[model samples]
Target: MVTRREWLLASGAVAAALALPARSAFAQPARTVKVAIGQKTIAPNLVNLLIGEGLGYNAAEGFKAQFMTVGGVSNAQVAIDRGDSDISTGVPSFALPILAKGEWGKAIHFYQYTYPYKWDVAVKPESTLTSYEELKGKNIGVPDFAETAFPVTKNVLRSLGLDPDRDVKWTAVGTGVAAGVALQRGAVDALAYYDTGFGQIEGAGIPFKMLPLPKNVPMVGGQFLMALRERIAKDRDLMVGYGRSVAKASVFLAASPRAGARAFLKMYPEAAPRGSSEEDAIKSVLLATARRIKLYDPPYAGAKIGSINPEEFRIEAQMNDMKISSFDAFLTNELIDEINSFDREEIKRQALAYA
Candidate 1:
């Protein structure tokens, strides 16, 4: 297994790329908002986030954005709980368990950045595992045990009437080349991962036959931007403005995913693999992120982004065998209107006119 220390030593580019200078706007912000995410590499689903930074969406909203890279979601939550970071990124299902503890002190999942979970369970082309039932007693691979993929896989197994803990074994295969290599060498039977994980593997020439999400599963509300309740109450402008900036970036990226991929490439050139061509790098990112881009567009009838869908989380709670006292405790739609109050047509025009 690739250790975290080894991974960090090899990821100097990722660290260097994150040392971004603050974008300039007509008015400077009062303070820097530290936003944490549980990733080292630039995943496809984060195309909108990169675009948001690249295009000065945060600066336009009157704040400076600092992207912080941490070990995992659990760590990211700790960062927020300990007052180290203001906001963290993660999906709804995987977050349910951590949020249920109430130990995080009223952390609110205020922003819905991506939705209709573009997650998958898959097997190698030669594997005979075609259904969830077949997954019983089999080992599964995930990027990491701390990620949403593992819990989602466990709950998916539960939906199939199998004991997730006893009936299945899970292994952390790592991500990018490490994950693909694990699957290639038969380190695990099947992979329970998101679109970006699968796309990168396929991009490396390892194909998979995706197992369909069980009928009982509700794969909506992919990922969220979470912040502490006190922070939201005290820093309402920063919270809402950041969401608005992300909404604008999401709109622009969703309007033209290819353009978004191109923009990401230009913004973070180090994102590409050392020897990969620009065209190949674009294809790799697009392959991983294209399906997710569709969900970036506002799903609500009002054409607004970042609106929390509690019902989806409720179903997610049921599927994951997690208990929630109340959805409103951790979810909110109070800022949806302000978040979506942007001129989306202009974003589309900019997307279309990308040079």
Candidate 2:
């Protein structure tokens, strides 16, 4: 059964993208565009610039992409609203209510569905922790107090008949890396982190066990790609160009995982090893990154994965049962389709190269 959020988001996005007039407006030169990356370090979302920056795709299309750490999804939304950034990429579920507040108004449409590979609980490998019920009365650390991690953690706890508030003491440890360090140091009994952060801990030689979420619990709602709705409305070509850049990045990432991982490590040296060959470490990073990205692949061929579609409605229903307000806020593919058409040949070429 389709959930309300999927219907709402998809219908709204499609309607908005389709309603735009096709006539070209005034000519404008390339402008420096700023993007707000909510996360502290580089990840797949930066795949656009990681590839585009090196390949001059953004320049070829007409914009220089600038990135900065902007705290949580709310922070990125506020930044974009206050004109601190032009685009913001992060968790979509948390951003919806803010978007409904007209934060960026008609200037942005939330596009792109990132997978839910970012949230999980890890325990020290030495601990005999094999299940969620085993975590009762433990100290759990998460990046933020009110973020989705907390809720997901609560959901899991509830499913295991554990009250998170009463059974477990939760702390906000700031970054996943910090959480990993804390867990390794025995400061926290367990750390709630995502796939990449978990990769870091494993890479650091810390053996940890991931606690399985309850079978009935919902998969964490994924990240989103949001743009300035006004910019898209006023400058269709620029919007199309931005979309093309994203596609190019995704294709390159799929085609050249190792090279992509190398680029990723270059943007984030902290993600690489000190003595390992850059190529080897990058290949490791790329293999891991590719695995995570596959979770976001849309069901359709060459389709954007991980976004709200028919498959997520049931999850949304579960969220509603958990008291999450459900509405018609599904992610729409109209803009992506439009953008894909403009650069379909290039995308196909890159995909072929990667294949």
Candidate 3:
């Protein structure tokens, strides 16, 4: 026989015991993966990564991604080479030369972001440069002579019957805003870079005219996720996990890009400078996301989000004049196939539910 107080105390103890296990069950710690990005600022591509993290996609794959910004792809590669980062984003055309020369450890490209040869040659709005033909003998600013932009731009010029070496002058201007400054100051007659570079220039309120690359030229490769071959062999599970997480994020972005913008701003509030409206920042991000989404359609026909088209790689290698015994030396499809193995319908449903 127990008093009323004694009965209440027993009930409270039972409740505590039941709740403790539930809390512990939900509290699993996540593993951390360091990602080194080429650009210092938060672009739409970075926003997709951030949204994936915010939505626990990375954690679901047993990873907690930490993104570090080095100045350029070269810098990001240096960081990875030094073992300061686990993975880095870069262009295969740029990395291949280094790999061919044995300057860096062999790497595996696990993901593809943009289609090759998507760069545009742009000029000031008031300028008379209307065709690639006119660019001959004109100063064209590229991010780097050794990077993808230079070779792609050269191919475009060659296609137009212009001698890249003798007819056009190439200048290595810094990326995005810096390149825009070169154009604004009349330092370069034209600027050739990725869509993001042109986006940055337009976003800064400087109107510009762009000449699109010809569709006939073989597609050069685009940006990709790379890790040392040794790391991939040792940590295959982690690489597969990253692919799975990013695949889901890609579907989510395609379904709802606005949600991506909101997530980006929430994760990095500093992206919006002082006196700028949240709405404006969100719009900017959405625009960037839209551009990225376009890169996934049509030319890149596939179900897997990060699928690397072998033909694209072959074409890129040919364009860059590099010899590769096998494409497998640089890329692997195992992880991407695993990522696509997830229920496609369910992924689409999740993306649609973002709104």
Candidate 4:
């Protein structure tokens, strides 16, 4: 098994750390948390974080979220593992592999950031590839080889009766415009990535024929809010505060997706399209965020927002071949009640009044 230190050194954790230059957010901050995201782009996947910032949710919680993106989910997890960041958002599959390899004490996922399997495989316009089976021997362009899509693609191919190592070629096409360009120029035959990434790709004016997820793999869990176990143990208030803000942000977004998009643009004004009018830009963001918003719906995420569903993790580990000794070993719902301690109607009221 590769030790955590060895993996960090080999994975260029130092470089990843540098990419996320130190910055601060709140002035009288009780806690300054370094939050790592998968990609740098201002896509819908990150709108909740933006909402948290624009709406002052984090500030109200007494902690400041200093955000950074290292391009992929695995790298984001690595940021937490290397102590480059105190918390990160990632999938259970990404963290399980690390735990299966004995990389303990790195981090523990406590809150469900996203509530469903949001990844998908897509072929560019004019391609006849209707099924994932057609992906055999085809080039798959992903954001990163260590990303959630990488392992998910591998498992998907396996379930489709294809040998992933021998049947497919994978390339790191980054995200958004880079991914769109790669597919446009035929650098890869198919694009395997997550929800908001595809949203950005579509915004590039390149249509896509999305392939359905393989039916055999029972992957259910999605992105999560992860922090060190020690951090949660010693500083419970910080974890509860941060996650509570995120949960409220989720509620605010669900209450009004358009408002969420508006909040996103408000936080990152440059994210607004270059020549487009304000309403048009906000509409584009709404379109990009539509699918992701569905994942956080009441029916899918269930009544307890941000709570851990053990069955989901069990299925995730089983399908991905991670030897998880126990579901509780990697996650906890103990903080769920605390994280969700927010008034839904108040968030709805705020969303309605959002500029």
User: By lDDT, who's the top model here?
Assistant: 4
Task: Score residue 284 of candidate 4 by CA lDDT.
Answer: 75
lDDT of 2 by residue, 1-355 (tens): 2233433333322222211111111232358666766554555434544455544556667876666555445555555555666666655455444434433243344455455545678888897787778778788888676355765567567656787779989888766456677888888888886666566556556677887765765554666666656655666666566656666666666666665665566546665666778766775575446455555455445555323453443453354343334333434455766555545456546545531
The best-first sequence of candidates by TM-score reads 4, 1, 3, 2
| Poorest 10 consecutive residues by lDDT, candidate 1 | 1-10
Compared with the true structure, the alpha-carbon lDDT of candidate 3 equals 0.67
Question: What RMSD value applies to candidate 1?
Answer: 4.9
Model 1 regions lying over 4 Å from their true place = 1-30, 98-104, 298-303
TM-score of each model, paired residue for residue: 0.87, 0.74, 0.82, 0.88
TM-score-wise, the better of 2 and 4 is 4
**Top model by TM-score, which number?**
4
* 315 Cα displacement, candidate 1 (Å): 1.9
- lDDT score of model 4? 0.75
lDDT of 4 at 167: 92
Candidate 1: tens digits of C-alpha lDDT, residues 116-192: 66678888889988898899889899898767788767766776789988998989999876787787789999888
Worst 10 residues of 3 by lDDT: 17-26
Candidate 1 vs candidate 4: the TM-score winner is 4
